[model samples]
Target: MISKSTIDKVFESARLEEVIGDFVQLKKSGSNFKGLSPFTDERTPSFMVSPVKQIWKDFSSGKGGNVVAFLMEHEHFTYPEAIRYLAKKYNIEIEETEQNEEQKQQANDRESMYLVSDFAQKYFEDILWNSEKGKAIGLSYFKERGFTDDTIRKFGLGYSLDEWEAFTKEALDKGYSLDFLGRTGLSIIKENKQFDRFKGRVMFPIQSMSGRVLGFGGRILVNDKKAAKYLNSPESDIYHKSKVLYGIYHAKQSIAKEDNCYLVEGYTDVIQFHQRGIENVVASSGTALTPEQIRLINRLTKNITVLFDGDAAGLRASLRGIDLILEQGMNVKVCTFPEGEDPDSFAKKNAYEDLVLYLQENAKDFIQFKASLLVEEAQNDPIKKAETIRDIVQSISKIPDRIQREVYVQECSRIMDISEEVLFNTLAQLGKKNVAEANKKFKKERKAFEVVKKEQAVEKIDVQYQLERKIIEILLLYGNRTEEFEDLLLKENEEGELVLEPELHKARVFEKLYLDLQQDEIELSNENFRTVYYGLISKLNEDDSFVIESYINGLDSELSKEVTSILMEEEKYDLSDWEGKDIYVKDKAESVAQLVGETILNLRCFLIDKRVSDLRQRTLEKKDGNNHEILEEIMNYHQLKKLLSTKLNRVL
Candidate 1:
C-alpha cells in the first residue's frame, strides 16, 4: 500500500491546471480554468479546474476529483499507476514496496486490460505500416479514402492478413496473452477453432472515451456480398457497442475546446470531418444513440450538433436522438447536408473553413429543425398535425431545465404554427407526468440506497457511532476550550521586579477532552475521525496550525460534510461572544494570557481528578508505602479538586 506521507506529498505538489492542461487546452475562466472534457466528444468546454482547491470537475459528465482521480479517469490508470505516473512526471522518487513475481503477474484488472488494449492498438498500427500485405490492402484503402498517412496513423487504422491465424500467431509469439487478445476481440476462438477475428479485414479499433482500445470494428475489403460488411467485437468486460462512440477518445479534448460535439452517424463520417480539421466530432458508428453514448459525450460537452446525411435522411435518422438529447439536459442542434450528400463527401468537397461555416449556417435548434421538416408531412390533416405537435412538445418537455424547455416550447409554437397556450398546456401535462415517473423511480432508488446504507452500518457498528459523536463534537465545540492550569507563582527578584511563572500550566479542552477519553480507555470510534484526529494531533505536535479545509479536501463527501458540519456547528457555539459571563475577562495581554493558561490548567486538573476518583470508586488502591503517605496523597488530591472547582466556578 502507498503510505499516507507519499499520498499527501503528491497531492500537495500536484498543480491542478498543469496536470489537467496536458489533455485539455484551458484558458482563464474566472479564478479557475475551463476546457473541453477529455472524457467526452464535444465542441464547447464545460470541464473546470480549481487550482485553489486542487480539484477538477466536468459538469457535463458529473465526474469530479483531484489530479489523481483525473489521471485514473482520463488515462485509465489504477491508483498506484496514477501515483507512479505523477511521481515520474514531477520527478519525485517513489518509495514502493517490492512486489513478488507472482503478485506482479496476478490477473489484470480493468486498467490492465486498457494497457493491454493500447499495446495491441500500437502493435496493429505497426502491422499496418511495416508489413507488405498491409501496405497493399489497408494502406491503399485508407489512401483511397483520401486519408493522409498522418491521419491514418493518428486514428491507428490497421489490417489483418487474409491468411487465417497470421495476426493471431504473431500476437501470441510476442508474449501477449491469448486470453487478453480474445477479450479485446483481436483474436477469435471457436470449438477448437482459433484465429484472428478480423482476418482479411481493415481494422478500426474502437476506443473507450479515454482512448483505450476496448474493442474493434473491422471492414472486409474482399468483394463478397456473402460476408457481412462489418464485424464488431461482441460485448466483453470492457466494450459495449450500444454505449460507445467511435473517435470519442481522439475527439474528446477537441470537443471540450469547441464547446460542442459534432455527432455523425458513421465511422467514415467522423474520419472525414476529422481529417478535414473538424476535430471536435465523433460518430455513433451507425448504432442508435444509447443513453450511455450520449452521457459519454455529455462528459465532454453539453452542446451537441448532429451532422445529418441530408435533410430528408437526417430528419428520419435524428428523431430518437432529438428527444433523448433534450432529455439529457443537452443543447441539441441539427444540421442536414444537401440532398444525396453526407458529412464524409461534403467534407471532402469543402475546405475546413467552408465545412465550419456550412455547419454554422445550416444548424437549427432541434425543435425548429423538426417542425420545419415535418410540418409539410402533416399538411392540414388535423389528426396527423396534432400528433406532430405532440411529438415536438414531448421533446420540449424532456428538457431537464425549465428555461430551456420554455425556449424550445416557444420555438415549437412559432415553427408549428400552433397556439402558444395550447403548446404550454400540453407541455405542462407531459412535464408533470415525466416528473412524477422520475420521482417514483427516485424514491425506489433512494429506498434501495437506504437499505445498502443500513447494511453498511450494521457491518461497522462502533465505528459509525464514534464517527457520529466525534463529528458532532467537532462541529459543536472546536474553538471553545475549557482551560485546566491553576496557579501563577510570583517571585520578587533582586531588582524588586516580580517574576511570575505558572506553578501549574493549563491544557486546552480539546487536549483535555482527548486525554480524558484516552484515560477512560476510550478512542475516537469514527474511522475517518480516528484517521483525522491522529493526523491533526500529529500535525499540531509538529507545530502546525490545524487546517480543517485542507484535511477536508482529502476526505470523501460523507466525511467532508461531517467535517463541514463540525466547523459550521462550532460557529453556533460562539466562542468570542461567550465572554460576557464575568468569567476569565482580562484588560491586558498578560492578563489575557494568564487567564487562558489558568483555565486550561484548571480543566486538565479536574479531568485528572475525576479519572482518579473513578479509578478509586471502581477498584480500591491496595498497597501503600505508609498509611500517612496515602492519607497525605488523599489530602493533596482534595486540594487539587477544590482548586479545580474554584477555577471552574470563576471561568464558567
Candidate 2:
C-alpha cells in the first residue's frame, strides 16, 4: 500500500485540468475549462473542469471527480494505480510500507500481472541496450529500418536474446512467479521447461491509455521462413488486444489537441508518423478493425481519417472500417497513399510538410470515397449499381446524428446520380426493419423491466431522505459558520400547565445541528449520510475554520464522491445564463440560518408524521378494544407534526 503522505502529495501536486487535459481538449471558459466529454460523443461541450476546486464534472455523463477519481473512472485504474500514475507524472517519489507475508498474499492477481509485464519491458530494453547479441541484431534491425535512436527509446523498443531460458532465469531470480510470467505471456513452459516467448525479437511494448505497459508486440528479425514475422502477447488478466489500440498512449494528447486522429495499420506505421511530427495517429496493430477500437478513438475526437495504401487490399480494409466508424457515429475520412506504398513506407519517403499536404489534399469523406470506389466497379451494370447504392445507404443509416446522415445522403444522391427520395425510401425501410427487430427484443424483456421499475419505485427517495440530505449538505457547506437560531420547547410553568417557551441561541452551525438532532432523538436514515454527518461533526469540533478539501481527503472514495456530488451538482445549472440575464443569485451563506432551520423542522415533522401513522396502524390492527393509548400517542404526534408544519409555512 502507498503511504498516506505520498498520496496526499500526489493530490496536492496534480491539477485537475492539467491531468484531464491529457485526455480531453479543454477550452478556456471563464474561470473553468469546458470541453466535449471524453466519455461521450457530442458537439456542444458539457464537460467542465474547475481549476480552483481541482475537480471536474461531465454534465453529459454525470461523472464528476478530482484527479484520481477521474483516472479511476476514465482509465479503469485502481486507487493505487492512479496514485502511482500521478506520482510518476509529477515526479513524486512513492514510499510504500513493506508488506508481510499475509499482506503480500492479499495483492490482487491483476496487479501482479501488471508488475510482471512492466518488468519484462524493462528487461527487454536493458538487453537491447546492454547485451552483446541484442545490440548487434536488434539495434541493427531498428537502425536499418530508418528508426532514429531517440525514436527507438521513445517507443521503448528492445530486444530479447535467442537463448531459450535467458529471460526466464533472470525473471525467476528476480523473485517473480512463473504463474504471473505465464499469465502475462512472457515466459512459456513446455514439459516443465521454461522458455522466453519473444526470444531473438525486437520488442515494442503496448501500453494502456495511461501509459502502463499491458503487453508487448515483437518483430522477429531473423529471416527464417518457418517463423512468424510478428508476434503479440496473448490475452491475459490485464491485456485485451481487441480493447487496446497501439500508440493510443502516445497519441491521446495530440488527438485531443489536433481534433483529429490518423488511423494506420501497423506499429511501425504509427511510429513513422510520430517520427514525422504527426503525433495524432494510432494503429489497429495489424488486426481487423473492431468497433471497440473505433469507440476508443470516439472518446477523444469525433473526426477520424484512415490512411491506406492506394491498392485494392487497402481499399478493402478501408471499406471494412468505414461502416464500423459510421456505426460508432464518428466522421471518418480516407487518405490513400500512392500505389504500392503503405503508411510506413510513404511517411518514410516524404518530408513532413509534403506528407501533411498530401493527406489534407487527398482526404475524402466516407460517402465520397465509397461512391468513387464502387462507381467504376458498377459501370454499365444496373443491378450491381443498385446494390452498391444500397450498401452506401446502409452505412449512412448507421449514423446516429440525423443532420450528418441527411447531408451524407444528399451527397450520395449527387454523386451516384440517384434521387434523394429513393435513398430516403431505402433508409426508411431499413429503419423500420431495425425498429421491428428491436421491438421483438423489447417485448421479450418488458416484464422483467417492469418488475425492476416497481422495485426501484419502492426504493425511491422518501421525505426523510430529502430532509436528511439537505441537513447534511448544509452541515458540509456551512458547518463552522455562526448562526442565530430560535430554540422552542414545551415546559411545565408555575401553574402546572404545559407551555411553549422560545429562546434565542447564537451558535455555530455544527453546534446547532448536533443539539437539534440530539434533542429530537433523530438519526440519519441513510448509512452513508450518517457516516458523513459524524465526520462533519468531528471535523468542525477540531478545526476553527472549515476546509472541505482537507475534510474530503480523509474520506473513503465512495463517501468522498457522494460529498462532492452534493456540493457540485447545483453548480452545474449555476454555470448557465441565469446570472448574465439580470437574475441575482443569493449566496448560501446569506441564507444559512433559514436553510438550516427549515431542514431541521422538516425532518422533525416527517418523523412525527411517521410516528402518527404507526400509531394509527396499531389502532387498526388491535382486535382487543385497547385503542386509548394508541389514540393518545397518535394525537400527540399529530399535534407536533402540525406545529412543525406551521413553522415551515406548510398546511398539513
Cα-based lDDT for every prediction: 0.71, 0.86
TM-score of each: 0.69, 0.90
Please, what's the RMSD in Å of model 2?
3.4
lDDT of candidate 2 vs native? 0.86
Residue 603 accuracy (lDDT) in model 1: 42
Cα error of candidate 2 at position 563, Å: 2.4
lDDT of 1 by residue, 1-652 (tens): 4666676777667787877765566766545677666666554566677676566667567666667777877766777777876776678777766677897787466655666677767766877899998888889998898889888888888887888898778777877777777777777878787797877888888876545678888898978988888888878878889878999878877887788999988777888888899989998887789887887777656799988877444466568887888777789999988988989999999998998899999999887788877777888889988988998887777787888777777877777778889999998898689889999998979988888888774454443353345433432234233454445454666997445444655665356445545654655445766765665555445543545435655676555545444443322222233445555543322343344444445445545565567655534555643456555666666655555555456532
Residue 150 in model 1: lDDT: 84
**lDDT: which candidate is best?**
2
| 1-652: candidate 2 lDDT, tens digit per residue | 7999999999889888888888776777657777777787665678888787677788888787778889988887888899999999999999999878997887788888988998999999999989888889889888887999899999999998988889999999999999999989999987769899998899999998889899999998779999889999999978889989999999999998888999988999999999999999999898888987887887678899988876646475458778888887789998888888888888899999999999999999988888888888999899989999998998999998999989998999999999999999999999999999999999999999999888774456678877888888888778898988888787778997555577888999999999989987888989999999998898899988777776776778888777777777666664574667888777777888888888888777778878888888888899997999889878777766766777778987
